[model samples]
Target: MVMVEVRQRLVVGISGASGVIYGIRALQRLSELGIETHLIMSRAAKITLAHETDLKVAAVEAMADVVYSPDDIGAAVSSGSFATMGLLVAPCSIRTLSEIATGVTSSLLPRAADVALKERRTVVLMVREAPLHAGHLKSMLAANDMGAIIAPPVPAFYTRPASVDDIVDHSVGRALDLFGLRIDIPRWRE
Candidate 1:
């Protein structure tokens, strides 16, 4: 008999941020890479999706292999034992970042990130806020100190992206690189 390895799993969190498209594109790319995705979306994230994208909440949910409610604190991903490659909170809102930084997770989204940090697994936060103040910078530094990568989705103009989707894909692809997933996207030449 032949044996096969289980597909790698990744936890994806979408918070209430302006760029929900980053989370959506992350799921799509992970699926293309044959990695299983477990998703947790906050209520604010659903509202933001409706306002920002043509995609419905149900459509976004369907992109994941499994979906957990943000309020479900007992979810599998909230436990460090639930093996996963890492947690990626694309377009992480300031509230979520604050929660994770302070270790006061009110929802499964930040809780999962905390678990990943405790397990020493990769936790990438595509923090999407702009005009940040000192508090935001402090929170980011705190999270980084706790082994979380604060990867704001800054566009790489050096890639000379032709469209908004290209920019998003490049950012998403680069974020996935932290997990050792090399996706096929334009790279900056040194």
Candidate 2:
């Protein structure tokens, strides 16, 4: 009998940041890997998706195995009892970042992050703010201190990406590498 691997669960939270494509690509990649995904989209993220991309929110939500409402603060994700391998906040806005960093359990994202931290599970924050100010820096520091990985979606010219897709793939692959998943990509050599 062929043994099948039990897929791990990942919570993907999309904030109202500029790079909605990053979240989309991440969800696609996770699906391709056969990992079960739970998705949440902030109101601002919905607006950016409508304004910046041709894909509808429903279309994006269809990619995930489960989709949770952003305003549903009392959802299962907000509880630590929910078993999840990790949480990733793609295109994390400054507001969400600040809330998570300060231990403010205002919504699902921050609350889920808190659960991940207290449980010692992985929490990757792909913060998308630019032209950083002192406040942003401090919030990042706070999040870092609380065991969150601050993964900004900065471009890497070293990969010699030919298009936006390449860039997205590289970034998503790097994020996956954090969880020890091997995908097609060249490692950064010394």
Candidate 3:
């Protein structure tokens, strides 16, 4: 059982959203916890990381045990037999959300997420859009119904973070908790 838990794999998907650091932080925490990581970043996400964050694609990709090309739909992650615990779409773009919600598996990210949902594993989407319209909300509801946890990157004032990394870590930590990871971070008490 210990080996089973230790072998638990996490799939991290980076989308073309503003908060690329959240995905990177999640990968760092997963590495520290001895969890195997499989990473997939959309082409647009690669460009967004360069424009919005200082970290290079190779640097971020290094955190994962395996990295899949976003264009490769036949990647291991896209198959249920790959046996990942689930996929976490940090900074999940609205575009990606719509694709996954509607069963569009053109890329490895959505295909992997689809496999996760079918396998009844946790699929957490750290949605990063604001001022959502009706269509966006509808898409989110569809995804939710399909067993994906819709996690928006909303700040938690209760954490009282002093720096941007703190805020990012808090959100990433909470996301990890969904997978039963006891990451060491401040939590609100009753």
Model 2, C-alpha of 136: deviation from truth (Å): 0.2
lDDT of each: 0.95, 0.87, 0.91
lDDT of 1 at 169: 97
Model 1 gets an lDDT of 0.95
Q: What is the RMSD, in Å, between candidate 1 and the native fold over all Cα?
A: 2.0
Comparison by lDDT, 2 against 3, better one: 3
Q: Evaluated with lDDT, which candidate comes out highest?
A: 1
Q: List, residue by residue over 1-190, the lDDT tens digit for candidate 1.
A: 9986778999999999999999999999999999999999999999999999999999999999999999899999989888999999999999999999999988899899999999999999999998999999999999999999999999999899999999999999999999999899988673
Of 1 and 3, the candidate ahead on lDDT is 1
How many backbone clashes does every candidate have?
Answer: 0, 0, 0
> In candidate 2, how many Å is residue 71 off?
1.6
Question: Candidate 2, which segments miss by more than 4 Å at Cα?
Answer: 1-6
- The residue pairs that clash in candidate 3, if any, are none
- Writing each residue's lDDT as its tens digit, candidate 3 over 1-190 gives 3554358799999999888888988999999998899999999999999999788999999889999999998898888888888999998999999999999998889999999999999999999999999999999999999999999977888988899888888899889888888787779983
| Poorly placed runs, candidate 3 (over 4 Å) | 1-6
